[model samples]
Target: MLSPESAEIVRATLPVVGASLDTITTRFYTSMFTERPDLLDGLFNRGNQANGEQRRALAGSIAGFAKALLDHPEERPDRLLSRIAHKHTAVGVTDDQYVIVHKYLFGAIADVLGEAATPDVIAAWDEVYWLMGGALIALEARIYAQVGADDGRTWRQWRVVERREETPDVVSFLLRPIGDDPVPPARPGQYVSVRVRMPDGVHQLRQYSLSGTGEEGLRRITVKRVRGGEGAPEGEVSTLLYDTVRPGDELTLSAPFGDVVLEDGDAPLVFASAGIGCTPITAMLEHLVATGSRRRVLLLHADTSPADHALRQDMERLADALPAAERIFWYEADAPQGARTGRMDLTGVQIPRNAVAYMCGPLPFMRDVRGRLRAAGVAARDIHYEVFGPDLWLGEDS
Candidate 1:
């Protein structure tokens, strides 16, 4: 619990600090990589100055974390801990890393604030950092312990047992860990970090949603290698994983981590995904059928062409299995084939009035989906999203 006076100081400083978020985050990252550049191996992506929504989310999440602490220390954000856990896994952040980040981050804040950061004010922020970081660490530890357990019921790891290109650009890998025979469990909407040692010996990390249906022992992730796509630099790990890595390769992985898995188990679930972002929704479709989620479910996937429509056979199989269930709605932005022949618009279309919505993909796709969902009168809370890069949705420097 924060002291009443301490909390008051936080409240007073909130506006000014929030306004200066960019400065602090920029300084923090600079300080971090400068001191411990080696940690960049597999952790920080090789880039600077966030672009697109990725940049926005990174800045937003950092500022949001602080704002949440200062503003609502008593109520506590339910998804906050889970969000941090997801971030930890996404970036491969560890216990020691958090300490380093917080140390420099707060130090930078002090420098920026100058006289405003009185000793008392500094102490209050300390409590806030520890409290928030403690919550994140505790949740992270619990998630990690799922691995390295004797019981097959818990988490499991797998080696890159095989690799195959299903299409020219679409590649899939078979993971078979030396540990547990049965794969560790993963929620439908969760994702895993695939860590690869770079040519320069810098371990690089990238996240891919598990394509196979919660297959713990033999998990598979199919990635559509974007050749210089989406600001994708000479993808440090993704390239090697695609071009060089062979079967029997070893890579460290975190357990499934995400907050936007299937929810509203009783209500109808609507899945809208675009491009490669279809991975998670595809898993959810299989999960819904496998778990016998009787609630009506609709899958709306947007792909550019017939070849780009991933898991068509598997989705068809799942849909066929659940013949009596809801429905499978695939919206293809087929450029080459010109199938649907138009952009997706739920305004006058297939999205059910009462369905809960989950969407993923590029920024434009998400923005379009959100507009359509909102236009369809979906409640704000009922719609959720998962983003890549950085935590960027909280606030901007308005």
Candidate 2:
């Protein structure tokens, strides 16, 4: 809980701080990375930084945490914190990093605010920062312990056993643990961070969803070669894996860490995905099939074309194995016989009542589909979503 005095101060200055968060965060990253260049080598994604998504995500989180503290003074925002904690643990973030971050972050805050950043104001926001940071540290510690990564070690060596091309731009790598260390159990819909040394001799990390169940000492991850468009640079780690990684090659992988997991229940399940977002959903479907689940399942997907959809055959095969499953797909071109044409439209589709939905895809597609699902009577709380990269959807109004 925030101290009463700090709460009053935060409530008063939230508007100013919120309004200037982008500037404050940009300055924070600029100054921090200038001094701590080592952080960029493996800890932070340069692509996210170059495209400004990382800064935006940081701004959103800080503002959101502050707002939540003021709105719900009696409770901490565990949901928000949990999501962040999982991501932090995935990247092997440690407790001491918070202090390093605090130094530059508050420095930026003070620099940006100038005379407006009085001691009382700084103290108040400091309380907010530590409150958020402390909660995350505690949550991350618990997660590390649960995953048997309490030794402050998150990465393990895994050798690629097989590689299969799923689409023109997508490939799947099946990996097996290379050491005697027990592989941490991965729940369906979880992801692992793959760390690779770039040609520049600096290590970079990217998280890919476990596309297949990690069973029998094997795990699978699907990678899509991200083509640069607009102003964003192409994905460095993905392209490297897609073009070079093959059988018998070893890769560094983090223990599975993700907040979105397939809930275990017999209730109706709705899995919606688009393009490469099908990875996690595919894992969940595989789990369901492996467990011989008889629950009603509805799989909805969208893609540019049938050939462009990764794991298209796997999705069809898994759905076919389920007794009460229906698959619907939409393509902009080359729609299959049973699939729909153009973009996904749920106008005439039947959605089971009291269904729990899991969605992954582009923000626009998820937003539109989420609205349709809400209109079809699925509760907002039942509609869980996973974003592939920096979750810009965090503080957005649903």
Candidate 3:
């Protein structure tokens, strides 16, 4: 809980701080990266930085945390904190990094706000920052302990056993430990960060969803080659994974971490996805099949065409294996027989009253499905979603 004095100050200056967050974040990254270039090697994603998504995400988080503190001072922002902690742990973020972030962030605030950033304002925001950071540090510590990487080390080498192309732009790699050491188990819908050396000799990292169930000693990750457009650079890690890495190659991966996962229950499940977002949903379905679960499952998917659907066959196979599973597929072109054309719509679909829907896709698609599900009597709490990259969902939803 915030000190009453600080809370009052925060509530009073929140509008000014919120309005200047973008500028503060931009200056923060610019100044921090200029002084600490090594952070760009593997810790920070250059692609996200180049396009300003990282700055935007940081701004959203800070503003959201402050707003939440003012709105519900009696409670903590567990959802926001959990999501951030999971992402940080996936990227091997450590406790000390919080200090570095605090330094540059507040410095940027002081610089941007100038005379307006009085000592009271600074102290109040500092309290908010440390509170958020402290919560993340505690959660991350627990995650590391649970994963048995309590030494703050999270990276491990896994050799690629198979590389199979699922689509023209998507590929699936099956990996296994080089030795007989027991592999850590990952829940369905989790992701692992893969770090690779770029042509410039600097390591870059990218997170890919664990696209398959933990099948004995093996794990799977699906990668979609990211194309550059609209002034954004192409994805360095993904491009290298596609063109250079192959079977027999060893890759560095962080322990699987993500807040969204298939809950252990017999509740009716609806798996909705579009494009490459189908990976995690496929993993959940595979888990259900592996466990011989008899739960009612509804599979909903959308894509540009049948050829463009990365895991169409596997998705269909898993759904077929389930006794009470039903499927509805939408495609913009080349709609398969018995499948609908154009975008997905729930107007005529029969969604079970007790269904818990898990959706992963573009922001627009997930937002649309989320709205439709709510309109059809599904509670907001029952509809969970996953974003492939920086989660722009909560900020926009808020």
Candidate 4:
């Protein structure tokens, strides 16, 4: 809770601070990285930084947290905080790092705000920062404890046992622990962070969903090589994983962490995806088949074409394994015979009355599907979504 004095100060300055958050965060990252280059080695995502997604996400989160505090003084933004905590824990963020962030962030705030950042204003914002930071630190500690991870020793060696090409651009890697320690258990929709040293001597990391049954002893992750166009640079880690890493190669990976997992229920389920977004949805289906779920499941997907769809065979096999599952597909290319030919349309599709829908895909695709689902009488809360990168879908009321 904020003190009355501080609350008034924050409420007064939020407009200005929010307006300048982009500049503040950009300056924060630039100056912080200039001094602490080690953070870029394996901790921070260099690609997200170069593309400005990280900056936007950081700015949005700070502004969002502040707005939530002012809007609901008695409540905390657990949803926003929990999502961030999971991502931070996945990358082995430690408590001390928060202090470093505070120093640089406040300096950037002062730099951007100029003389308006008076002592009282600075202190009020400082309190807000610590409130958020403390909450994240506490949540992250609990998550680390839940996952049984050492404070800073989160990385483990995994050897690739098999690599299969799912599509021309997507591949799946099967990995086994290099040591005798058993692989940690993970939920169906969780993801693991894979860290690798690029040719330039910088260590880079990327998160790939656990695309198979989250079983013990082995793990599988699907990677889609990102070929950049229209000003976006090629994904460094993904390109390396595609062209260099192979069976018998050793890689470093973090323990699984993601909030969007298959919940225990008998309610009907709607699993939807587009392009490579099918990874987590595939995992969810694999879990359902493993458990012999008799619940009605609607499996929907969209892609450029059958030839471009990753894990197409796996999807069909899993859907067939479920006695009550219905599979639907949409392709950009001409529909072959009975299949639909255009983008995903749920216009005539019959969704279960009480189904819980989970979707992962491009932001635009997810937004469109979400609107249609809501119009079809599905509660907004019942429709869950996951974005692959920095959540550009930040301001949406999802």
Candidate achieving the largest TM-score:
2
Q: How do the residues 224-252 of candidate 2 rate in per-residue lDDT, one tens digit apiece?
A: 99988887678888999999999999999
- In terms of lDDT, the best-performing candidate is 2
What local lDDT score does residue 66 receive in model 4, on the 0 to 100 scale?
87
- Tens-digit per-residue lDDT, 232-337, candidate 4: 9998889889998899999999989988889989889998899999999999999999989998999999999998999989999999999999999999995666
Model 1 TM: 0.84
> Any residue pairs clashing in model 3, and if so which?
none
Model 4 residue 218 CA deviation in Å: 1.2
Candidate 4 Cα errors over 4 Å, as ranges: 214-216
Candidate scoring better on lDDT of 1 and 3: 3
Off by over 4 Å in 3: 396-398
Residues 129-236, candidate 3, lDDT per residue (tens digit)? 999999999999998887879635788899999999999988999998776765667999999999888889888888899999555679999999998888768787
Candidates in descending lDDT order: 2, 4, 3, 1
Q: TM-score for model 4?
A: 0.97
Clashing pairs in 1: 42-203, 56-392, 57-391, 57-392, 58-390, 58-391, 158-177, 159-176, 183-216, 183-217
In model 2, which runs have C-alpha deviations exceeding 4 angstroms?
none
Give the Å error, residue 22, model 1. Answer: 1.4
Give the TM-score ranking, best first.
Answer: 2, 3, 4, 1
Model 4 residue 58 distance off true place after TM-score fit, in angstroms: 0.6
Error of 4 at 43 (Å): 0.6
Better structure of 1 and 2 per TM-score: 2
**Candidate with more favorable, higher lDDT: 1 or 2:** 2
